[model samples]
Target: MKVKVNRHAAKALKKMLEEAGAEGKLFRVYVTSVHGDHAHYDLKLDTPTENDEVVKSDKEIDFILDKNDEYLDDIWIQFFHVPNEEWLITNPSKGGHHHHH
Candidate 1:
């Protein structure tokens, strides 16, 4: 699996981790639920579980991905602050047909 975290997201996540006193923990990115061809994710600071794959990004962050999730390949995570503060995690390699409501 390939995961990329943009600069904004990386900065925000680092600050959050520091505030939460979660330094040194891996950034865990995993599927919380799946609907049809779409999946919802949960991000947290956690220790590595058995068989978990670690993906390093931004030279200072480590992302934990499930070794079994092939659908997460080529995923991009972004932090947005224009309309509102939010995290956008998407698979750009997939077909751009996600319906938002």
Candidate 2:
């Protein structure tokens, strides 16, 4: 299991954590639902539960991932600036799926 967080995403996430007073909280990325081969992502600041994989980052943040979710592996989080500023979460392991925003 691998999770990569880019610089832009790390900065943005730091700000979010600071603003929400959620420092030291676990940044959890999980599969909210799965439709066929596509899986949706959900992020939240919460406590770690049993059977969670902790991903390491450069900053003082804790990333908790469920060990049971194979679909959440190899996740790449990046901030895009083409059309607008938004966070794009892509799972290269899961073929491809178009997301309309």
Candidate 3:
């Protein structure tokens, strides 16, 4: 798993992880659901995980995954604004997106 977290995303994630006492844990990224042509990603900060396929950015607290997500190699997560302003996650490789705005 090779997870890359953008700077902004990293900052946001760090706050959440630190509060949960998961600072050193690598953020685990996985596909938790799929609807039609889209795959929904789930994030977890697991401790001393035995999984070697997970990748985390040294500059941020987010992950890029290989654990059952090898097919999503080119998957990109982007945050966008909509409605009253919210972050949107997009997966170009999967050909669809789910708005969280």
TM-scores, all models, native as reference: 0.82, 0.82, 0.62
Candidate 1 segments exceeding 4 Å error: 58-60, 96-101
Model 1 C-alpha lDDT versus the unseen true structure: 0.73
Q: Residue pairs in steric clash, candidate 1?
A: none
Best first by lDDT, ranked: 2, 1, 3
Write down the lDDT of every candidate, Cα atoms only: 0.73, 0.74, 0.56
Candidate 2: 10-residue stretch with minimal lDDT:
92-101
- What digit string (tens of lDDT, one per residue) describes model 1 on residues 1-101? 77888888989887877875686787877777677777766677888888788887754677888888865666677887888878877766664322221
Off by over 4 Å in 3: 1-4, 48-52, 58-66, 79-87, 99-101
Q: Which candidate would rank higher by lDDT, 1 or 3?
A: 1
Which of candidates 1 and 2 is the stronger one according to lDDT?
A: 2
**Strongest candidate by lDDT:** 2
lDDT of 2 by residue, 1-101 (tens): 67777788888888878875685687788777788987777677877888898887545456888988987787777767668887777677896542321
Residue 78 in model 3: lDDT: 45
Residue-level lDDT tens digits of model 3 in 11-91 = 667677778576577655566677888877765676534444645455544464655554455454444333443444556
